[model samples]
Target chain A: MLKLDKVNSFYGRSHALHDLSLSIPKGQITAIVGRNGTGKTTLLKTIMGLTVKSTGAIDLDGTDLSAQPTFRRARAGIAYVPQGRQIIPDFTVRENILMGGFASTSGRQVPALVGALFPYLTENMERPGGLLSGGQQQQLAIARALAANPQILLLDEPTEGIQPNIVEDIQNIIIRLNRDEGLSIVLVEQNVAFARRAGHHFAMLEKGRAVAAGPIDSLTDELIHQHIAV
Target chain B: MLDTIFIGLSVGSVLLLVALGLAITYGAMGVINMAHGEMVMLGAYTTVLASIHLGIGLLGAIPIAFMVTALVGYAIERLIVSRLYGRLLDTLLATWGVAILLQQAVRLSLGLAFFGITIAGLGTGLQNVRVPAYLSGVISIGGEQVSLYRAFIILVTILLTLLTWFIMYRTAIGAQVRAIMRNPDMAAACGIDVKRVNALTFAYGSGLAGVAGVMMSGFKTVFPDMGTPMVVDGFLVVVTGGVGSLMGTVLSAGLLGQINGLTASVSNDIIARAVIFAVVVTIIIWKPSGLFSYKGR
Candidate 1:
């Protein structure tokens, strides 16, 4: 569904991503698991057009997305949930959810559809985003991406700040979205066990390049302990 | 004595309008926007020029002035302000340069002579009060007499304040604006077009400033360096009121206006300015972040 060929992204003189290539199959949760500062976020930024300088090809459904801005990339059916689940705190739950509709391809309201993805959001639609606790904000953040109805959802640490119970809720939502909705997902995470649950495929990034890539089954517990357990 | 409060409110209302837009551009956008005061100058000068040169009525001149100044703001942002945006000191200096250019441009074209705008049938005095004399005329609250215009200005300020509050807090665009302000990266990730919203916010903020300029020029004399005088206070109001908070901006402007009006009656106007500037400095040195935050930005 998505392909990156010989992609290199830079932040000033510091090279954040090397000549890395990644591809995702349809209807599966693809996990790019790495320690912090391992170019995982940079990869997502490059795909989302948030990177300042990038040299490579990013194609989604055969349409080149390397030159588009972040918003443009989103309109092209790529939804991203950034690190820390950055919600617009001053905005009400409904407003934050409505913000997701900005990438609505049809230019029509989809409240019922969004409510289906995260019912709690629909329930507390009038409350300010800041008023929600950490876990609830994470749900709202994910629901916001779902509201966009993208072909692929790129989530960066959706479970980082939430409690264990809410983490399970997020995991279940991810499962439902992928299994039932057939939405492609590129999840960047630091937790191995968390990544192992929904991740059907895994790639380990070190320094700035992908050092390992294969199906989730190939990433044995020993390999996970050796590289990602830290 | 009651008339003094009225004077303060009229002055405060103009300050509120001027400061309200500054709250959005500098406060919400983090653009520094030193050119904001200059935009107000552009509007006032545009209004005067429209009335004098084109003989346009005030009604026609209002929207025309708004648009032209908005375009001026848009062009400045696109050509100059946008480039200097990421760098704080650079944006400050660049916008100041734009302000100087605008001021000098007006001086070069129109010269130093002041121009008068005669409102069709409206005179300088408040011949008609919206409320009855007992209600509209200020009673002594604090050893000061407020006049009808000043009282009316306070009421108008409240109304516009509420309107802006509703637009910013309850509406969709308001959410977008606050979203962009809080977390541009998150907002971008969520599919909100940061640049487009930013441009609109800049234009809208400066446009409101333009309206303030139009209203101010009607009350005061229109001169080339008119905006320069208040540019510092504009900064101070935002700082003291807490950066980007609409309520903060209004409160600060009102406090500053009353202090300035009351002080100028007794001491030099500079004393009034010094008092307000002192408060702003103290606030920043103490709590750099303003009272209200568009958090997560």
Candidate 2:
């Protein structure tokens, strides 16, 4: 389980995430839903220790990760697939995927899971990542994260900007990873219907604070209208 | 003409060594390390001291100089450069201060001047390293006579540059370095220790500069201020070639060195310097990013 308790994150003086607390249970999908600029991304960055400064405790499993650096936090089994699918443009697809293996306890290698799920990436392993389409780039990003052999996956809008046909494919893969691989996932998504479909638990954020959180069933349309609808 | 061209090649080789480290550090870390030239000064000094104290020859002093400068570079990264990662101007200013400190440290013989004590091979005085008997004389190549030491400098630079290429492209550490050079935050997110890689990169670059110093000490009189002009020359190569492109550095160094050599051969060293500066300014105005800048996606 990954837990954040009263975390306040800052970016060189501008407060990004206020006193926020959230828990992501093991072997479950927790969707973080909120309006634009509501700190959904900051929460994920805070967990990854990417923020300039953050106060409060971040516990991953039994390991206290608040004081740990980003690389250490990743080594401890939290893999982040950030927004924009920030793959190295010049790096080959194989190299891009193997990059996540730096955090893997097993060392650097393309995991069998990546080859199984991302066949296109496996086929184009020699091609530069920048040559891929947006959907393909998203797949490469996920494949890269999976190579880490992470216990928890933090995805920030994985389906955003992807083609409509590939969107469902990506969403289904996210569900399968949670159900079949039994991996804990913290999903920051804007598609409310898809969030309700995939998330076992939900957290509604507002101005960097979690105003509503509970089982996915408790995420009422009223709550969505009140906090997320713009 | 042939002798002048050979001289240009040798000069270009030394410039390549000096610019290589500056290219990597400035390209990867965005640090304008004004103290980079100090590493060269330290390397030349290391050769002088090694000869005087340990009775070590020029060849023997090479590795020692590398190690000494690398350690100093690591310390600079850990203490000062590391703190000023994103602040480019601050890093330039801080490293310039470090450059002065290093120059003064060498000039004063590590503060021994205050106590009226002077080390034999140190302090504010010019020094020279004797070339080995084998490298002291010229050899016939084709129909031209080439200085054996100059040939040795060219050969060593070629070998070191190849070694650098292998390390950057064929090694795991190299991949991490390239990754950091492209996107530091993403590299960290992928679990690459950006700080560790950066420190190592800085040390390696300093080591190369030290080797350049040793090469310079063989041919020129070494003094406290010898490396100051070298820093400017090295940056000229880096900027004209392109910040991060190794091939660019190599080619531009050769081009500029040839320009300097050919012009100096025709006119004077002062005129050659002016011509080189004019060419660099033209290149900058023409292609501001560099000759072979990496294309962003």
Candidate 3:
């Protein structure tokens, strides 16, 4: 389990996440839902230790990660698929995937699971990542995260800008990653229907604070209207 | 004419050495290292000290100078640059301050005067490195007389350049550096230790500058002020070449070196410098990004 207790994250002088606490249980999907500019991305970045400054406790399993750097945090088994799928454009698909392998305890190698899940990436291993379509790029991002051999995956809006058909595909992949593979996931999602379908738990955020959180069954439509609606 | 071109190639080789360090440091870290020239100065001083104390010649000083400057670079990164990451202007000012401190430190003999310890080769004076007997000779190829030392310099540069290329393109560490160069955040997220790699990269670049100093000590007067101008020249080459491109640095160093050589051959040294400055200005106005700029981060 990954836990954040009373975490306050900052970007330079601007406070992005304020006194936020969260817990990601093992082998389950927890959807973080909120409107635009509501600290959803900030929460993910805070978890990854990418913010300018942060105060409070971040624990992965039994180990305290607040003092650790980003790479160490990654090596401790948290893999991030950031917004915009920030893969290296010039690097080949193989290279992009291997980048995540640097964080893996097993060392740098394309996991067998990547080949099984992303046959298109496997087939065109030498092609530059920028050449891939949006759907393909999303797949590549997931494949890259998988290469880290991470126990916990933090996916920030994984289906934000993809085509409708590819969105369903990615959604299924996320569900499979959690349910079938038994990997824990923290998903920052905009689509409420998809979140309700896939997530076992939910956190509703507002203005850098978690306004509501609990099991998916308790994620009422009224809570969504109060916090997530524009 | 052929001799003049050879001279140009030699001059370009020196520029390449100086610029290579700037290119990597500036490219990878977005830092404008003003003390890089001091690294060259330290390298020359290492040559002087090694010859006097260790009885080692210029060839032997190459590795020693590299190590000395590399260690200094590592210290600078750990103590200063590491803390100032993402603040470009602040780094520029901080490193410039470091350059002045280094210059004064050497002038004061590292403050050894308080202890009354005096070193012969380390005072504030102009020094020259001695060339071995064989290297001082000239070789005739195709009835053209070529200075063997110049040829050796060119040969060394070519070999080093090739080695740098191989490391950057073929090695795993090199891949990490390139990945960092493109996108530092993504690189870090991928589990690469950006700070560790950056420190090593800084040391390697500074080490290259030290090698350049050793080469310069053979032909130019070695003094505290010698490195001041070298930093400007190195930055010029880096800017004219693309900021982070190894290939760009190599090609631009060659181009600018040739311009200086060919112009100096035809006219005077001052005029040659002026012409080179004009050419650089023209190039910058034409392509602000550089000749072989990489489009993305």
lDDT of 1 by residue, A1-230 (tens): 79899899988788899999988887899999877888999999889988779998999889898988788889888888888777778777877777887886865254565677677778888898888988889888877787787889998888887888788888888878889989999999887776788899989998889988889888788777777676
Ranking by DockQ: 2, 3, 1
Instruction: Report the backbone clash tally of model 3.
Output: 1
Against the true structure, candidate 3 reaches a TM-score of: 0.98
Deviation in Å, model 1, residue B136 alpha carbon: 16
Model 2, range B256-293, lDDT digits (tens) per residue? 99999899999999999999999999999999988988
What candidate 2 gets wrong by more than 4 Å, as runs, is none
> What overall lDDT, based on C-alpha atoms, would model 1 receive against the true structure?
0.76
Q: Which candidate, 2 or 3, would have the higher DockQ against the true structure?
A: 2
- Listed per prediction, chain B TM-scores read 0.80, 0.98, 0.98
lDDT by residue (B1-297, candidate 1, tens digit) is 446545666677878877887788875567777778877777777676676567764445557767877788888777877666568888888888988888766655533333453432122222111122343444555666545445544665687678778988877677778777667776777677877777877887787778677666655666656787666667777777877677778877877787777776677767867876776677788878754533453
In order, candidate lDDTs are: 0.76, 0.93, 0.92
Could you give candidate 2's fraction of true interface contacts? 0.75
lDDT of 3: 0.92
- Pairwise DockQ winner, candidates 1 and 3: 3
State chain A's TM-score for model 1: 0.95
